[model samples]
Target: MSIVWYYDFISPFAWLQWPKIKALAAEHPITLRPILLAGILDLCGQKGPAEIPAKREFTYRYTLWRARQAGVTLNFPPSHPFNPLAALRLCIAAGSSGAATEAIFDWIWGHGRAGDSIEALAPVAAALGIDDPVAAIADPAVKAQLRENFDAAVAEGVFGVPTLSIDGRLFWGDDAHEFALACLRDPSLWNEPEMQRVAALPIGAARQA
Candidate 1:
């Protein structure tokens, strides 16, 4: 099974760990899957980062330290937590076309003021080495597929941004990311009894023949 890198470009924390994540993906047999985030939040009745009152302060402070630690250059700019629902759909729109979606993912989380404006995405897109993902975003089939991804993420028990799932076990949080990296580096570490039992399950009766 592959690891799913579930993220929304609008999340700063998601942007922060991106460098390491991409590097980790390179070193392991991981398929970086980008899922649209806003749909997940809406389905859950969760507000944007800038909207939540109780946890917002602590979250930003934590994110600042995290960005510094990861060496990601971030400019939050003057913007409310801009919605990336459309962008998320756009990402789904660009599926399997190559690095366009991945590049778009990086730009959304990595650069200046993610979620503020579509224009902000241009520079990040350039950095990812793809300037035109607009074509994918504009397609009707792709748009619907993206919406479906958000629905899928919610159905899968995802509650946070930058969530990762490996072999169907969920890892949610930057702290969990390292664990994901470790499991990917050494599949032998996955000898837990539960997983072994599941893996060993017979698909069909041997006596059927």
Candidate 2:
């Protein structure tokens, strides 16, 4: 079986889950799908927890704690909510190699760089041996591809990063890693009768009449 991983580099939780997924990739086929987290939030009409004043602090602290717990390195960028469009387009340019994706993730979340400017992204592009990243990001084809990925993600019901999906089953967030691995081990779990019935329950209503 194969897994589709939806991610955005700006997501710290995605950063934390990076190593785990990389290791998991060895045992399962994984296709990396990059989309703009901001775009997803916009489509869902939902504000990220970090966008809330009260939750922002806790989210940051908890992200750090989880990073420590996972033995993953994480540092918030110099600023919050910086645009990662260029870096993301670069990933599209790079053809979404796990190494390339992780390199950008690490640079932003691990090194805490303000990846908002093309100047900031220069070294990352140079290190990856990508010529003229600015031009690549400027390429209408690359821009269209990123938009397509975002549109595909929204259509697939993806609401967040690090979402693992197969055959219409979704396992969201970093905490669901092991559960995803388990489902991979037993594909039948994807269609258990009782679970399917439960999934059919109407939203905001406990029982269907």
> How well does each candidate superpose onto the true structure, as a TM-score?
0.71, 0.91
Top model number, TM-score:
2
Per-residue C-alpha lDDT of model 1 across residues 1-209, encoded as one tens digit per residue: 66667777677777666666667767655555566566667767777676776677777777877778777675564454666755564555545333655566545544454544445565644454445656545678866666565665676788777887777667777767777767767866567788789879977745441
Residue 202 in candidate 1 has what lDDT?
77
RMSD of each: 8.6, 2.9
**Candidates' lDDT values, in order?**
0.64, 0.84
Instruction: Pick out the ten consecutive residues of candidate 2 with the lowest summed lDDT.
Output: 200-209
Candidate 2 clashing pairs, residues 3+ apart or interchain: none
Estimate the TM-score for candidate 2: 0.91
Error of 2 at 174 (Å): 0.7
Report the C-alpha displacement of residue 201, candidate 1, in angstroms. 26
**Over the full model, what C-alpha lDDT does candidate 1 score relative to the true structure?**
0.64
lDDT, candidate 2, 1-209, per-residue tens = 54788888878888888888889888778888888898889877789877998899999999999988888888899988778788888888888888789778878998998778778988888888888988878989988988888887777799888798775578889999888878878988867999799989778856443
